[model samples]
Target: MVNNRSLVIIALLAVLAWLASTSLYVVNETQRAIKLRFGEVVETDIAPGLHAKWPLINTVHTFDARVQTLENGQSRFLTAGRNALIVDSFLKWRVVDPNRFYQATRGSTDRAEALISPRVEQSLRNAFGSRDVNTIISEDRDDMLADSMASLDTAMRDEIGVEILDIRLKRVELPEQVTQAVYQRMSTERHAEARQYRAQGQEQSERIRAHADRQREIALANARKEADRLRGEGDGEAANIYANAYKQEPEFARFYRSMQAYRKSFEGNNDILVIGPKSDFFRYLEHPAGGASK
Candidate 1:
């Protein structure tokens, strides 16, 4: 009998433990929760820490209140100039009103993203449609994103209980065919410029070569003129010396002249002279003083 009583007490304790578990719930700082009765939401925004409810009658659902991200999506958009671009992007969002969020998404992150994505995409499309590729990619990019959120943020807040924080574009590029066409045009322009530069360089080089040739001709002409002047001066000085020698000693000059004539007249082995020996050409040979015969 005592064993049966002890078994009953243990079974009661087990039942109490089960009741304790179902009666209490917790909501931490990073969580947002809703209490439901019979699968219908009865309360929302439950405070953090432990709270009590009727066992097996009340249930709670919790969601992360922290910011969420939707990433790695690509969309095609057109520019004001009708240029097409493939944009890779991501979005930041979070639930702001738990009651309204529960109504809208039924506490499903997937559903929330599904509803938010198209609106964000449409906003970006509008923003991109108003601007050119240069403006969208350059200094006005942030402003364009801000403008995109003008209506999107309002719609998300009012209907979906979500806040659209930011939209970041990872990459923007042209389609493959457009890219190829642009590359070909740029290459043609570069080759033409290179040809122009080469022609200009050759022209300048030819001008420099012609100028150098002209200077060389002038230098050679000046050298030849100076050399001729010096040669004429040397010949004139030699003639003056010869004349002075004759002036100083006329007979000595006559004797020297006769010796020179004799050496030239017999320089060859075969010789014949038809002139008279009494001619003035033999004065030196005849008198040894180059004087006229006595």
Candidate 2:
């Protein structure tokens, strides 16, 4: 009787331990959980802490409630101009509604990704299709991404219980078969731009040189005019002085003139004159006293 009682007590303790183990669960701040009863969802978004449920009847599912990233590999898209481009992209998302997320993706992250990726690809394709190559590659790229993120978030939140945080293009490139042709076209465009800049520089240089030449000509003309005015003033002053001297003494003026002529004629000792002896040049030499025939 004592042995049977001890065995019965051990079995009861084991059953209680099993019930406790199955009923109690812990949830952390970084995790989100859902409870199911007989494969039917009963509770979603369970708060973090110790919780109790019906032993052996309730099931709990936990998921990481953190932001996640998905890197979708390169995909080819067509621009408005019908040019093909390879776009490498990534996505950021997080589960906001656990119940809806569970229903839409059946708690399979891979399935969620599979559904989200097609939408992203389709969005990108549409965006690229409506824009030219240059616009798609450079100008409207950020705008397109912003628009895509908004559209994707709306669509996903409405259908998948997942919120799209962002979508970004890692890289954009041309197809291998068209890379050389595209490169050549880009090179040609750059060369043309360089030529245009050079032409503009040359045109500006020519304008500057022409202006400088015009300024130089004007400066030279002004200098010549000033020089001619100064020369005229000097000549007039000299004539006035000569007239005043002649008025003071007429005979002295004439004798001074004759002396100047003789000095000029015999400025050098090697000078020779072949004139008549009674020439007016000899009048002063003949008189040499008071005066000569003026």
Best by TM-score: 2
- Candidate 1, residue 263: Cα displacement in angstroms equals 12
User: Whole-model lDDT, candidate 2?
Assistant: 0.89
lDDT of 1 at 148: 80
Worst 10 residues of 2 by lDDT: 285-294
Please report how far candidate 1 places residue 85 from its true position, in Å.
1.1
Deviation in angstroms for 125 in model 1?
1.3
Off by over 4 Å in 2: 1-13, 137-143, 176-180, 196-215, 218-222, 268-270, 276-279, 283-290
The whole-model C-alpha lDDT of candidate 1 against the native structure comes to 0.88
Question: lDDT for each of the candidates?
Answer: 0.88, 0.89
Per-residue lDDT for 1-294 in model 2, tens only? 999999999999999999889999998998888999998999999999999999768998887789989898999998899989999999999988888888888888899999999999999898889888777656755677788789889999889889999888899988999999878999999999999999999999999999999999999999999999999999999999999999998767877888999899999999998998777777768876535446
Task: Point out the worst 10-residue segment of candidate 1 by lDDT.
Answer: 135-144
